[model samples]
Target: MSGSISRRDVIQAGAAVTITAAMVSGLAERAVAGPAIIPFSVSVPETALRDLMRRLAAVRWPEAETEKGWSQGVPLHQLQRLVDYWRTSYDWRRFESQINAFSQFRTEIDGLSIHFLHVRSRHENALPIVLTHGWPGSVIEFLKVIGPLTDPTAHDGRAEDAFHVIVPSMPGYGFSDKPSAPGWNIERIARAWTELVYRLGYVRWVAQGGDLGAFVTNTLALQKPSGLIAIHLNLALAIPSPLPTEGATLAEREAITAMARHGTDGSGYFQEQATRPQTIGYSLADSPVGLAAWIYEKFQAWTDNTGAPESALTRDEMLNDITLYWLTNTAASAARLYRENNGHGPNQGVVAFPVGISIFPREIVRVPRSWADKVYPNIIHWNELNKGGHFAAFEQPAIFTQELRDCFRGVRRT
Candidate 1:
């Protein structure tokens, strides 16, 4: 097959494949003959680093909000402090080293060069899972869990619990190529992911995602692609068809209240990005502090923090993600995803495949089981986490890893 072969081409060819070292070597040879799975390493240019620092030094400050606390948005004092730390203390090389420590690669799927971290387990019969990250988040969210997931034995877990993990940067995010056309919506991303897994030669696999990643994973389950056995989601997008009446239960009332608050106060960025990504993109692309504050505001609001985002994520951790967007200059392109997929939600009725959901208390909307059951009928596993919030993997990696291990225990192929 040629490098331009579609995923359908590979699936139609239908060859049984395993992930042994020898098999990987054979696959590498085939990659050269067909579409090349090139080994990828990240090296940010010194010129870019200098430019980022220059922009940071020359940031134009905005006036403080009239409100006392976060009722308005990220405070000026807090943002200045964070910006100072990011400029002086945050180390981009350290973050780059952490990512490059893993086995990373880029391969063309659906006419786009997709960047992904492909870490295989040493354990026998390890389950394969594709992890998708959301907006204001990159593969950085999964860095903490990668070691625990891929090498369970090393992390005080049995080898049988190990997973062959694939964390991909969605199109227009991180190192992945930005889409120039207008057709790259959530469903298109789902198709790309289907092709990605099949192209890697996996016959059976599971998928896990949170936020926008959850949207894509749920779409995958809805599509019922060939190799996808099951799916686990941190953010349940299963909005019931014909919409249920509001205030049915206490939980439902709370969910409605929370969603209402977000829609009113927290959706400014959402609206702008969905309608005029280019307008905001200019600010994000040009100003480093502007980019930092834009993303940092979400970290503050979405996390399980009481007063500040620092209560949940460390300064360095937040900077690592923000720096990725700044260095890659992907702020506008990433924002365009919202425009391409405006008003997209879960399909009505029950998804046929096995679905697992983990609910965090402080998620944008704390979905009730009654509401979720209307859409996800085959919910084999459902857990309400006592702590954590929207960015579950980033805030609580240990709990997130365990959730996946337990949720997929029965779903894994023998």
Candidate 2:
């Protein structure tokens, strides 16, 4: 049998089957001892769906914001409108069917079951790339780009640009098992990703991420794992310590101002999660409206939108992500990542591996090339995109896919 599994084989199988790492890689000695990879299909219980609908119908909405336009938080009218659609029009099974169409699986990594989507390209030599998602996001974030990435020929690109894509749900997020204890930080997650990729038998690959996933990808670069030839980040962790107050370029000054704004206005959720995840977890786990509002605020703030998040992402797209968290009951578990990092951020030190960076204009912080150089010592590719925001792939998948193709093109040979 070939090292790679054919999509037809996966599709033709009528039901989920057990596949071990040894079977995947033909490296029995190394993989046989590891956990078996179990086929997974997203089948939410009817009871859970009914319960969610009931909760949505019973939501106790708060009064509208005092000032117009998302000042205090997600506006009451906006949330009510979204809740109405969620109750009346939104369909969870539709998204579930879409996810099940792709190949999904779960395997234990460091005593935890990690859920992931693995899509193999028909192009035999397609590069393998593992994509990671952050808080308020699940494996669902990457669904839009999977088709374009895995089948470049069908998406108006050469076979050389194809990628065998892997997207994993971080610990305590989506279908992945929630951490039972502390110590599941970014470093630990990076190690788990290394074990996952190598277990699948890829001799060479790259990685890409944004938001909290960027921290994990940056950590992968820092770890310099075998087979991980390079990495790309949509959100650059390039902020320096003792942040330069003097001699600031226009871009730098603007970044500094943005940082200050984030510190003041944008960091409420950060502070809440970093300091008291469990406290907030109760409400997140119990109240559907609370979870929606919590995530909805970020969508409004982070994406490249014209006053409304819908300008950047459709109503269904936003609901798909929000529903993933709600259905999985992962709002609180995902929040714990903030507490685990303890506000450390990802700028630990110099990353010696080759790195690629795409700076979306409305990313939380628009990192300058000069700043990024200090952290990523061997910078290979850098592009400042005209549009997009924190959720790059979700907002502009075509641009995001093209960025990966361009950034990793140089290192594909190495």
Candidate 3:
């Protein structure tokens, strides 16, 4: 019991292991000491698949909502239809194979093993960019955009637009190890990401994120890591505090109203995750239907769909993300991130580094240009699209890809 501990001590203290069914097959390439990048792949155990099917089969149905729409929750019929497809036609192996085709790897950053995809562009001088995913999402969200960003020529873009892309599964999510002790906040994550980019031999790079990822990117901007040049955010966490009582623009007023509405109505999950993740964890970890309903509600509520999540993303796409959480048994660990952050809203610190903002019409709280300018003085790029929502990359990969291309184009020159 020493007051000051060593890195080895920290690692040992935090290395509380819990192996879920899915992790039995996909082991990291022979363990190397000290931050070594080891090749990794997803080979889910067949028993895990059997267990998932059995759990889905035994789901106890909940009564339909009292109303017709999603006001109460995910319409029972919609969830049933999705669950039916999940049980009958959904293919987990297809997703596994699709993701494995990319160059995936795991490395020790700090004390945790971080799982990431590193896809290099064929073109020379390709700018390196790290993409981060948030809760209820994983690297699965970026599968569609990886091609366009990594190989611009094949996807109708100039070679100059190419990005040597890196997408890391956040700590406590996907293939990454869950934290046993507290203290994996966004600031630590930003530092770890900087170390990640440096370890990968990148001297200069940019970052992009939405949701929780956006918070990390913003932290990167604040940290001003030696190599980090700029950051792009689909969800700008820059809502001015003391929201204007007078002289607010039409856009600002609308945004304020939306924020207020979300605080009142849509923050049930936020409050729960931030305050009592362990309570919800029991339901999420034990029941597949409970987990599906929990995430599916966000897909339905957050996406720019006409009425259902399918309008924004396919059943397979949504299920791929949801299943990743299920097989990995990461529901509670992921929710703890909210608790780590203390359930703060868009009150992130100001960022002076060059910043890019893309305002999706249906984002949780679309920050007006006025507020963005206040937070980011060197705003390099700002665009407001008529479509898309909170899960920008998962919903509109094409538009999201183009936004990154246009965003970094200005900085890539200087």
Candidate 4:
């Protein structure tokens, strides 16, 4: 063979062979000595599909809120329309087929079966980048950007802009195994990412993330793990130590006011998830409509839509994510993450690695550049977008893709 063997080659060769528990044990032994990447696929059982439809059909709706609009959470009429479509017209298999078209697998990392999509570029010397998703979002968030990122030439860009992309479902969020005990916080997640990249045989790589993904990426930069060249974050959770208020600009003042408003009015879900995820989990796991309403509220609040979620994301796109949570029975496990890392603040670390930031207009807390500079000392690139919101990749994939291509051009390794 003239070409060097890549990790994908080993996975492709073993794709057909099924590994039993005993074989997995043997692989575990081998893993201690070297990398143990496995090939995997997604196949929801027929029974599960029937069950989801049945549940959607038999929903016991709550009465409409006295107040109009989203001030009181997702309106009853909006949710009903969404549910009707989900039960009558939405297609889960199509979403499954879309994701399954890409290469996916589960590998044991720190005793958990972590699921990820690994797509390699055909172009030689492509930069490897790992993308992580956040709460209420799954690997589906990056589905739209994967092709454009991995094969830029096919998507109206230069081959040099190509990237070998890896999108991982955060533990307990999607197909990834839920943590049995309690120690899987942001820091631990970052360490597992480091191991995951190394196991995939990348000597040099970069990372990008938003929401909870941003927290993980920020931690990775702070840890300064070996082989990580740089990182880019859409949600900058930068808080100055001891808090400074001596000199503030108009934007800074506005950002502070927004932060206060979020703390007061928009943190009910945060407080509940942080304190009592199990309680809400019961309602989430049993009632499909309940789960839809819970998540749908965030879609309305976070996106740049003009008071209507459909303005930003289609009903199909929203259902695709809601269905992932429903099928995986991950509603509770996912929420418990908030409890696991309660009181966790993103402003403590001092990162020395090069950092790039793309600030969307409607992000939860619009941290001013002055605030971000306090934590990320070596800022290489920073841009403020006119549109987009919390779910940048899911909501504005083209803009998100272009942002990454432009942001990483300076930091790309040879």
Candidate 5:
């Protein structure tokens, strides 16, 4: 519990295992194994990044009329600010070094290069916490919280609360390898993660994730490995059950309506990525602006930030993520994950695991608490927050951390 992730936890990152797995829903108990040190890397090349910046500066964007806000795409003014900073001010090497500084590495899992940051706490009582990131978000979302989660004592917390954080780039999202074959659904990733934590030598641990990471964590929770005491997720409503036949509460009725509406608009990316990720990936791979537009739009729409995306995060911070995609040329590979996972991945069953869910206001987690409680029979924590939207980590790390600490409080075992 005190050390960073154990070297043995690395599996010889799997080769693309065929057979697309349905989203795992049925509840089952599983075993957690430490991964063998499957060699992995998160480093980006120097020349590729420089060329990406040059391409961004010379991008020929179609200007929109004043009437058209950011509805269709990012405005020229906004893109210029980001691109200008990317060309002159943003430093990819610095960000790369910063991310790698805290024990970053990759392991081939299911034939994909899974990039992850394993930060161990110096405290004797550190809890092993696995943090997963969602779609349109790389490991950057957890960057601010890594310090707080790994060294809570330095951040004015008790040593008992320290976390040996494992932050992985979802397959195809960052430094992780893109899936070449079918399958590689969220549940498989969860299974891979179950092995991942056990390999670290922790007898019992907790997991937390938001967005796609949330879905992955949800599957991990559903698996309910022997060492998995509990799982916490920012977006916790994925498994859809029969709607409440028992008359709906005001909140539940409203939530039902929201879920219906979300299917219409909130899920555009899922459709494109699930079906035609290669097309979108090719476009994004060739054009840096396209990649920014695809990923940046989510930052604006999903975040609770105002003024500009820059207001919530420095342009450099945002570009650092986009730069990773541009340099790695993994945009297409990243999109292919959607093809592999589909909607909510494989919807297998009703899990009775001890799951805790925290819903931020501006998210698709409109499923009422009653609905959530039915699937997670052992839910012990539920929170409704006002500050952040989808990328809660970046929007409100302090709040997110506190909520996570509270969710898994008294649940870890060394």
Candidate 6:
């Protein structure tokens, strides 16, 4: 109690039960208003993997006019090696078990079959937390923290810090179905999640997200949906009032400089996602290697990893996330999120809801404290993490868990 809440606090909340038989039956017997999970198992079939391997092997990689850096496209040789591992050793079954280790369930909400992991707290009055993952990430992103956050019994804390967590696979990603009609933007997804928690009978809860998830949580906070409590995010992007003046603090000046440089260099993925998801969709859809390169590039850029992506995340973990995308065939749908949320309407400026900003050291865009304060007027908690990057939960669960635990302290829910 004297120091900032530790992982021990979660373990100290004491044993408590959530999702009682009544709650479970109520959920099961509830009206079939949402989409029902068609009884099925995920599989790619042997023939399919082999076919994809053949395609990757047979790709007509064009010899670059010059062997300059990766300015043109994924370097052919580098991609092939990663592809080879994917074809031979990348095991989806192992990762699937890793994913299913948490409580996995699928429910149809608002005509969409949504897949989510719901981990209940051990405390009688535990807070409900919804964690969202952005593109190029799956629920696998949070597998590292699930134990510490949900079952603090093993962490030397009690259940009060435990959370009834809901981590959903966004529509058009993972096991979720592809969008048949248009307009499944961040706002739409936020609305769907809003409907989801409300129907589950949760009166109040907090939202935590990163990458595209940060954007979605921002929308949820802005929309002020009923039962919404507060929002916490690991990634923050700020556009200063007057850009950066020479008189600005060093951090502010650095933020401005970073904005100028990353805005230019860090925008290719946005361009592709916004403009031609379908044009590039074929490569990712057909070639596992191509998908690995595309996703791997982000891991390299966003992670704390050095030159080699494997330095931050093992090849198995990295490929596991990629394999979900490949088997689910969600490259274009995931990409279209950019296209759908483009030219935002409600999500353009600062949100009014209470917000907690957690700053990780190696995020692609790090907002200066002075800059962040200006944007998040309701910022009650601000922290500079010791370690981590864009993929906070997966790369560094301890830091991510602590940041969220401290940030959401005293945050009221609906």
* TM-scores for every candidate against the unseen true structure: 0.91, 0.93, 0.91, 0.91, 0.85, 0.86
* Tens digits of lDDT, candidate 6, 104-204: 65666777777777777665566777899997898789888878877766765565566778888899888776787888888889998887676555666
lDDT of 2 by residue, 1-414 (tens): 211122222222234443333222222323323566777777776667788898898888777789998999988889999989999999989998899999988888999988889888888668889999887777878999999999999998899888989999999988788898999999999999998887666667899989899999999998888878899999898898878989999989888898999999999999999999999998988888898899999999999999989999988999999887877778888999999988676477888889999999889899888889898889899999999999999999999999999998887776
Evaluate all candidate structures by whole-model CA lDDT and list the values in order: 0.83, 0.85, 0.85, 0.84, 0.71, 0.73
lDDT of 3 by residue, 1-414 (tens): 112122222221223222111111122222212355777778776767887888889888978889989999999999999999999899999998899899887778989998889888887668889999998889998989999999999998999899989999999998888889999999999898888777776667899999999999998999999868889999898898789989999999999999999999899999999999999998998888899999999998899999999998999999999998988889999999999988466867778899999999999888999999888999999999988999998888889999999999987858
Misplaced by over 4 Å in model 6 are 1-44, 60-77, 345-347, 412-414
- Which is the winner by TM-score between candidate 2 and candidate 6? 2
Cα error of candidate 2 at position 390, Å: 0.3
Worst 10 contiguous positions by lDDT, candidate 1: 1-10
Model 1 vs truth, CA RMSD: 6.5
- Number of the candidate with higher TM-score, 5 or 6: 6
In order, what is each prediction's RMSD in angstroms?
6.5, 6.0, 8.1, 7.7, 7.8, 9.0
Q: What lDDT tens digits, residue by residue, belong to model 1 across residues 123-190?
A: 76777799999998999999999999989988878787889899999999887888888999988999
Model 6 per-residue lDDT at 59:
68
- Taking all chains together, the TM-score of candidate 4 against the true structure is 0.91
Q: Global CA lDDT of candidate 1, please?
A: 0.83
Native-to-model Cα distance after best TM-score fit, residue 338 in candidate 2, in Å = 0.6
Q: lDDT by residue for model 4 over 1-81, one digit each (tens)? A: 211122232233244322221111012212222345677666676667888888888788889989988888888999999
Ranking by lDDT: 3, 2, 4, 1, 6, 5
Best by TM-score: 2
Q: Is candidate 1 or candidate 2 better by lDDT?
A: 2
Off by over 4 Å in 3: 1-34
**C-alpha lDDT of residue 52 in model 1:** 80
